[model samples]
Target: MVMSANERLFYHVLIRILFVAVIAGSLISLLAEQFWVAELFTHFRLYYLLLQALLVLIFLHTGRHTLMALTILFAMPNAWVAGPYLIPVYGGQRATAKAATSIDIVALNVNYRNDGFARVAGYLRERDPDIIVIAEYTPAWRDELEFLRKSHPYQFGEVRPDPWGLAVFSRLPFMESELIDLADTDTVHARFVFAAGMMSLEVFAVHLLPPKSAVWARNRNLQLENLVDQLGASTHQRIVIGDLNLTPFSPYFSRFIERTGLQDARRVDGFHVTWPVSVFPVWIPIDHALADPEVNITSVHAGPDVGSDHFPLEIRVSKGVNKQPGQVRAVFE
Candidate 1:
């Protein structure tokens, strides 16, 4: 059916308005990365890129010069930001030779309210990871996880009822372990020495506050900065794993990577959405496994949802020849 002149004009104007809005919105979102207040938008960079791509397709049919310009404007920033993650050329590298000294770590944020204790315990038993890091680990959750004591005899962190409760259980013996307080959260820092005693790996189980408000976001940034400082001073093969509560696309996450010199395990393995498992589109990779340059990530993948808002992340890393003997000191006050 052919449209009347009035109807055609109405659609034309509507398309123009949307086109301009898309361009403006995309630009604002891209620029918002520089500021802490706009962190909520930065968390969904992948969603923004996908939305812009959809808008481009819709604008292509309009054939208006202004719409074309807007489409280009919208596409450029999204592509530039999302290109590295989407393209295979920027993928992470695997360790050339498999070293005898390697560790398998599993990080998960089991929602404090979710009572999937049996499911979580079963998954842990099946995976049998060398190290297990849990966030939102309440006192009850600790009781449920006690069954793991036989395998993971070495445990660290507190078993509080708060959402920030953190814990780490390892089969490997700990050379040194300490619980350090960040601004409003606690982080577990431990060094595990292999049985052979020739090499060691420093493990940090971190759980930063969720950026729900401006104050929280700023505090989370501070925690990240402090963590980076601590990791930077370390002289050992390091693995920072847990519910960081910030996606890799966020400005704070980028800053953390830059300051700590840690490589994201997802870089080599591919994106594995870990949060809000109940929701598909809004899911993001808040749980992560970051390793120092000397540690090579052999494999990284998200585990099956065991009744938690966040899925578990399992990462395997090979220790490099370069080993530093000193432990990382906590800088948090």
Candidate 2:
């Protein structure tokens, strides 16, 4: 079917508007550190590039070579920024001592108000991860989790009515457990002296206030900075996972990595969005997992949805060597 003159004009106008908006957003978000609204736009760098690529294809099909050229030029900046998070990590030689182990860690945000305990619980049993971290834990959920005691016998956390409540259930025994108060958020911290053949491993579960306004944005930044300070003084082989409420595109996230020397576990093949679960196409990865540079994050992925607005995250770690190859491995296991 052929479009009338007005119909063709309308389609052209709509595409032009979308292209302009995408270009503007890509540039304005660079100042996200100075303003909260800018920070909100910063999280969508990957999405922006995706939209730009689609726009470029449309331009080429419509024989608009100039628009196609400009679109590619603007998309380069976003690609440069979001490139690291989307690509796979460098596959380097890994230590293969006899004590090496592969451990699966899971993180889930069981929305406190969600009445889908059975769904989330069932998902856990199906995955059977060695360690689990939960956000928005509650007294009611605590009782409900009793069924998991047989598999994940060790438990420690703060159960509350608020969304900030956090919990950790593990098959491995905890050497030490504590609750840290950072920027009005109670962060759940857990330690495993010798998990499998790996030596000490410490995990910190953090949830920051959504940065919808200036005050909330500042608080989130403060929480991250304080957490970094604490991490600097903590033991090695550290892992931090939770609903960070900020994406990797944010300057603050870059600072967190720079200051603490932690690597994002999102070194995957493509975008792995984990929030705003819905029928809409808009989605982002606000929930994240980070680890020390030395730890090998074999894979990080989204788990089955558990009746929440966020999908659970499963991270698999491969420590230096085979689990039972060395005498040290046998002694620890």
Candidate 3:
């Protein structure tokens, strides 16, 4: 069929718009960890739905091929929508064991200037988690958290200045603890050994640097990548718990998953938002608990507010082969 000039122009314009959107999406993914951009996209994901509706209006009026292309291309947000609660794509490994015994592990990034240490300590004691990690812990916060040592004997972490200190408290005696110092200032990674099934297992607690600028984002990505590589080589049934400050949808987070072969705590459930507790609707899943493929994740959730800008995350895991090879069975089902 002979195409009119306007029709030809429409096809060319549509292809160009799709190309640009693809590029823009890639850029956004790279910048997902930046606070300003992350906040924008968090709200954008909601408004983009409305934007899609507007696209339909434009489609009806113009019947432009470019609008059609852009409309279809907007499906990229599905990843963001489903990204928070995606199930682990653990290929081949099936977690066979149920949570015969469960341990509540909590990860919290207590804002440095938080004055609610008493409330935070009370909240932690009330939950009685088997393990707890707090980042952005200042000297005062550490002093306040020290009271929990009676219940949790095994402690490993260092108190630092404003934005980067980390601490871990556990019921199990820590057989080992060392700050990984991953060539980055904001992170404090450590391995804690615990007894399980006549063998010792190690849990690594980490708080990665927040990716703000392009340079910072790339640096954060590299630091996490290196950490994952080291952990992947470790011979422990690993449970990595902490406020990573990165979300599941971010490319860096995705790379961390691919590099470590670890499963997200919420993969089988829903996205648990944990930040800006002072601001209602300021929700994003920055805190994380990731486990090795060998570990069986039972449950993952966000805890009650402890007066920190970020809420705590609790994840329960055990060791057992899955019911079927390469199948993810619901913990309850």
Clashes of each: 0, 2, 8
For candidate 2, list the clashing residue pairs, or say none.
98-326, 100-321
Question: Candidate 1 on 1-333: residue-level lDDT in tens?
Answer: 999999999987876676665565565666655665566666666766776666667766655556656676667765665556665334655444334667677988888898989999999999888888888889999899998788999887777676877788888888778887765445433333343235467777778888787777777888887777677666666778888888887767887876676777676767778888875477888888887655656777788989998889988766544354222332322
Q: Score candidate 3 by TM-score against the native.
A: 0.74
Candidate 1, residue 228: lDDT: 74
Q: Which ten residues in a row have the lowest lDDT in candidate 1?
A: 324-333
TM-score of each: 0.82, 0.87, 0.74
Q: Which of the two candidates, 1 or 3, achieves a greater TM-score against the reference?
A: 1
Q: RMSD to native for every prediction?
A: 4.9, 5.9, 8.6
Residue 39 of model 2 has an lDDT of 88
Which candidate number has the best lDDT?
A: 2
| Residue runs of model 2 more than 4 Å from their true location after superposition | 61-65, 89-100, 184-196, 321-333
**Candidate 1: pairs in clash:** none
> lDDT at 267 for candidate 2?
65
Per residue, candidate 3 scores C-alpha lDDT tens digits across 188-218 of 6777777654455677787777766666656
Report the lDDT tens digits of candidate 2 across residue range 1-333.
999999999998999899999999988887787788998998899889989989989999989999899999989978887866555535422323222367788888888888888988899888888888888888888888887778888887788897878888888787877777776545444333335455666777877778888988888888988888778777656778889998888889888877777777676434578897788977888988887766666678777778998999888777663233212100111
User: What lDDT score is found at residue 77 in candidate 1?
Assistant: 65
Which candidate leads in TM-score?
A: 2
Off by over 4 Å in 3: 1-69, 80-100, 184-186, 198-200, 278-282, 319-333
